[model samples]
Target chain A: MNLYVKQTRSISFVPKSILAVLILSFFIQCFWHFTFTNFVAKRHALPEPPKASFIRLASLDDSVSAAKLLMLWLQAFDNQPGVSIPLKELNYDRVIQWMNLILEVDNKIQYPLLAAIRFYAEVQDEEKQRKMIAYVSNKFIEKPNERWATMAHAVYMAKHRVKDVALALDIAKLIRQYAKGDNVPYWAKQMEIFILEDMGELESAKIIIGGLLESGELQDAHQRKFLGQRLEEIEQRQKKGE
Target chain B: MNHNLLLTIAKYSIWEAIRDKFLIFILLGFITLFCISLFIGELAITEGLQMQSAILGSTLRLFSVFTMGLFVITSMVREFNDKGFELILSHPVPRSSYYFGKFCGFSVAALIISFMSFCCLCFYAPVNMSLLWSFSLFCELLIIIALSLLCLFSFNSITISFSVVTAFYILSRSIEAIQLISDSPIVASGSFSYKFINSMLDVIAYIIPDIYKFTQTDWLVYLPDVKTDILIVVSQTLIYVSLISCVALFDLYRKEL
Candidate 1:
């Protein structure tokens, strides 16, 4: 080749090499990401947590913002035209993915968690509803924090969403353990009675009500009268056991 | 190949940007907005500092991209349309040198923006892993700057150039969503029409920058768990920017200007 053509060819080699490397690296990164999400997704070895761009805008540490973003994304599935139609048509797996991210980010946020629980229950996604309750219990209530309010919310979710009265009672008892004040323990006692009654554990529930009444914990006049009536009903049932 | 000439032109471009009123205004606005975000973050239930950092990081990315595109277009227009470029071309400088010099100048401006944003973020949040986000933002801006330059050189009209750059920005940011559409069952395994559309999307996907992979915004929130692959990001950015720069150089060489 002539000197000019040789120089031109030499210069062209640089960009050609660079282009090949770029394409190669791009595919390698893609394959790496694919393997991660498919194989290591369950292993939790994924390098980066993936989320919808809009939802990912919310910071992970900020559960409040995460909750807010989750709510907004869920609102897309509500009863509205143009927007809801597309979102509603989304596969259950897609909705589950969004829910899993939201629950992962902010299991302690009250309104959002409650809303998610209700939505999953309404959609008859029993597994997801149970998973939401389990997440709240595990991440929030089970941890060492003054999470009485959060525990109460979780108990409420268990009762309504999963209809697991026994599980709700266990959570209510766990709340009683973390209760630092008289007020929350009193509420927990009440929740225990209600859940036990719902579970058809009437004998256990009656015993709890009797102990609560005997300890004079139901000092509020209206509440006392209510407990007194409950005691009377239990006593009547016990006597009718012929 | 003339490194000294490229540095000189680049230094001049940086000086021009430093003196530009828009840069000053943006800097001031960034500081004010960061402070406002801190106060707004307090209203959050927990992780107030994380919230503040995220807001600042995202806003910085968006503002930097917009301003870089605007700056590249207007600067190119000022140089070419106003015959300012003739003064530089009168010298023995190559067209590629001039293009690379302008890119270097924009890169400096982008670095300054990233540094300022990171400084503001550090004022309220921890800087352990958050530094990765600013670095990624820098890489992201480098890609934008290169794209802006490429579009500016190819399309002489500022309006067309700006539109193309902005569209690229939006598409790159939405690459994941586009991939989802292509991957959806109806599209992936559907009839010929859907398959054709999916094929077209696949082609477009290959062309667009993957902006989603560049974002490490989660680091601004949960530091311990978020691992940003800086190697991949840096390598991808270098390759993309270099490729785009070569394209701009070739186009400018063919131009009769």
Candidate 2:
């Protein structure tokens, strides 16, 4: 009788035991959760802001070559191991495909569509570049800001790809006229003056450079020294001609 | 007269839920998860926003399905197993009030838990300081809680209720994938058994509320320009909850002690 009573008592304590176990398990789970989370946080250090890459696309000829070269450049851009791959890289092929797809349906836009314009400038196909610029200028006469990208493309086409100093100067002036005040970067203004100097428009270049020096925006010692040296060189060239 | 008795019962039921250790533990767990997510967000140098959004969204969805489902099943089962319903019905409280009171208690507990969890998420996730997201999250939480409670009340066994709810959660999460699977050429080419399985999955996807619809953590994370219509989504959630709760209430009223 005593033995049976003892067994019964032990059996009665089973529910209490189970309850205790559940509570202990819950606490242990909580502890593990926090510990694991903190461990992961400590393991991966925050990454640095990525450096931007500049690619000059003015040397290729055919659309296929342009597409292939763009893809190659994009692969290099997107090869960042820890950081996010650049959008320019990931969307490169997508942009090319979109151009092909759109061209299949309609090719009648007065301005070469966005994709064709980009491809033409990138590959430095002079005829295609001229057509795109003319089309853009005619079609987007009212929306200058929208045409800013194409204007930049024109500058690239004239200077780096086609080597047309006069046309580059013309496009640079247009860029200066459109990108005024807070909309423009100071470096862009400097680039405009450089283009004018390259085109032998020395007087206009000197005025722009003098204005830049007065504005105090070009205050960095290295930039000031470089601009001063370039100005001296241009003045020496003109004096020699005189 | 019986309404007052039901109100008192409901009041006590809510108090009981407040004291539940399980709910408290779940809240703690969720808070920890949110904090961890913030730390993880700091590591993502480039796609930090998108990563944060994905983590927060998936975490909230998982928390809803797991924690809320467990609370509903256990609480409902305990009430039946402990014969607490008999004690309440024996009082001056009407049977209708007793049942309604229990539902209200569970609903309120779920609401409070959801609200607390949402607040924690907002604090941790890099969301823009928009009151709209918080309010929308609250509404979604209520619907999820109500859905869970309905599943619990529909089944006799707590284990079965839990199983059904888990299955529902899985189906809801994978509804798009399931649809794609059904439409795949491989499935089409397979035997009759594969086709039948795919058809069954499609029926489940159609029948169940895709809980994924309520998840807006991604938007909060990404801070996208698009704005979601809150009123329409809330109304849809309310309709689903009301329909389920009504069925559960009718069944509960007819159930014998």
Top of the candidates by TM-score: 1
TM-score of 2: 0.52
Tell me candidate 1's fraction of native contacts, as a decimal between 0 and 1: 0.02
RMSD of 1: 18.1
On residues B1-257, what C-alpha lDDT tens digit does candidate 2 reach at each position?
37777677777766665566556776787778777667766654333444444455456556755776677678767877888767766666666676566667766766666566557656545444234454555565566566666666677677887787777666664566456545765424668887788788778767776554454443455354434556555776778777776777787677676
Q: After superposition, how far is residue B58 of candidate 1 from its true place, in Å?
A: 1.6
User: Which residue pairs collide, candidate 2?
Assistant: A57-A122
Task: Encode model 2's per-residue lDDT on A20-119: one tens digit a residue.
Answer: 8989999999999988755322222223212111111121111222222233333234345445543332443343343333222222211224434455
TM-score of chain A of 1: 0.50
